[model samples]
Target: MTIHRIVCAANRKRFTGQIVLGIRHWDLFMSEALDSEGDPVDQGFVDNRGNFLLRIEAWKVAEAAGQIIRRVGGDDTNGGTLYSENLY
Candidate 1:
């Protein structure tokens, strides 16, 4: 079983709506699933008016039968603020 650890980061945009901070990063990743050659995969995720819905958050997702999944970071609502806040 190949466990994929998806680590995502978030930042406040100057002009935009509200995001849970966690789902935003995942949404970006889903829309841009890349391979080794550095190409576009067309994640096929909808914008939904800027509402990011997480698989785990929704308690439902598509995955293999025995896949070890884990969401390291993303949502910072309940004291889950990002690990690092310095990215330049």
Candidate 2:
């Protein structure tokens, strides 16, 4: 397992975390939530479009899963708000 760095190109913010392996699955665990211009952010934040940025590596995991759905027991207006960085 590797600790990866995720950068939101839209916001220029960064997060440090690892891809956690589960029972035949994988998940993201953000050990360090955010770094906004060198300042630490305690909580999760989204973009103006209400989406989180997923880097290439994370996108690979999601792509391998066939589809990326919201986490279990997570707030569901329908699903999660995550988008691939490559898309933008």
Candidate 3:
């Protein structure tokens, strides 16, 4: 989380907020919610109820962080050039 914060601070034009997903949670989700081909099941995102619930929680946290950023005048409307640097 701290690393993400620093990176986002350095590249504010791209990132807004970060959500830390644990490896165990991700593994559990992949083991249960995905098909053998690594694709989502017929139910898609909600194939695993636990993972879906955690995803919703993370989304809400990020949304709240975005609202706080907007209130503090840190929105994405700064009109700065985001891709001015050349890609290697």
Candidate 4:
């Protein structure tokens, strides 16, 4: 199993999330969950309102992180650019 950390930045707020999945099966899982349209759902964003963290599983951290980066309006250039790294 492999775990990947994905961060979500929204409304000037930032949150830390993670994903866990099998290395071999990540392609199938990611393909189904992500595509050109984006994530299958907005659960990650919704869950960010509380103490929840968006957890996902993928074969590659970069890929999973990419999905998250796209969803949060951060592209390759601005991905993970947190305004405040220390909020907790």
Candidate 5:
């Protein structure tokens, strides 16, 4: 279960600020979640019109995603403002 965490940031001035965090299985699901050229899905977070911040691995995808969400804006009290999605 090679899990990979991806962090994405979207900043469009102060009107709209968004951070997207997600997880996917590298070995089992990455290929399916990505396109033929080894890129994330067309609708995947990374492909969205935003800044791709980071990608990491963890034992638990959810936990790792949460951590990435927390470190996004120097605080973790934004509740569910950080959107999340699973590629698989």
Candidate 6:
């Protein structure tokens, strides 16, 4: 379990709160419950199954995607950007 300090969108207050980690749905509902991580919260945000909502690390998510993209010939590095302009 990890504690994350965050602000609430409903009331806009800052507070420290406990976050439940090691849950399966942590990745799925993270964005949804992230707004309630601050002070003035009456209860911990959770789903019907008691899974806490938290944010996923961006780098970790990117790293996982990179592995999959590489396997499918989706490497963006190999592709070059082209800037087009109309010459009048």
Top candidate on TM-score is: 2
lDDT of each: 0.30, 0.32, 0.25, 0.29, 0.32, 0.29
TM-score of each: 0.18, 0.23, 0.19, 0.18, 0.20, 0.18
The TM-score of candidate 5 is: 0.20
Residue 48 lDDT (model 4): 22
lDDT of 3 by residue, 49-84 (tens): 223222223224334433223222222433211110
Task: Please identify which of the two predictions, 2 or 3, would achieve the higher lDDT against the true structure.
Answer: 2
lDDT, candidate 4, equals 0.29
Candidate 5 clash total? 0
- Per-residue accuracy of model 6 over 1-88 as CA lDDT, tens digit each: 4333222111112365445332222343443555544445322223233443222222222333332222222233324111111000
Model 2 Cα lDDT, one tens digit per residue, 1-88: 4323323322223354322211111113232322224533222222334344333334443434443444433223234333432222
User: Candidate 4: which pairs clash?
Assistant: 18-55, 19-56, 20-56
Candidate 6, run of 10 with poorest lDDT: 79-88
Clashing pairs in 5: none
Off by over 4 Å in 2: 1-54, 68-88
Candidate 6 residue pairs that clash: 15-39
In the order shown, what is each candidate's alpha-carbon RMSD?
A: 12.7, 12.0, 14.2, 13.0, 12.8, 15.5
Residue-pair clashes per prediction, in order, are 2, 0, 0, 3, 0, 1
Candidate 4 C-alpha lDDT tens digits along 1-88: 4344333322211232333221222245534433343323323221222332332221123355343333332223333322211111
Answer with 1 or 3, whichever has the higher lDDT: 1
lDDT of 6 at 41: 36
Question: Which 10-residue span in candidate 1 carries the lowest summed lDDT?
Answer: 59-68
lDDT of 5 by residue, 19-48 (tens): 323353233344333334432322223423
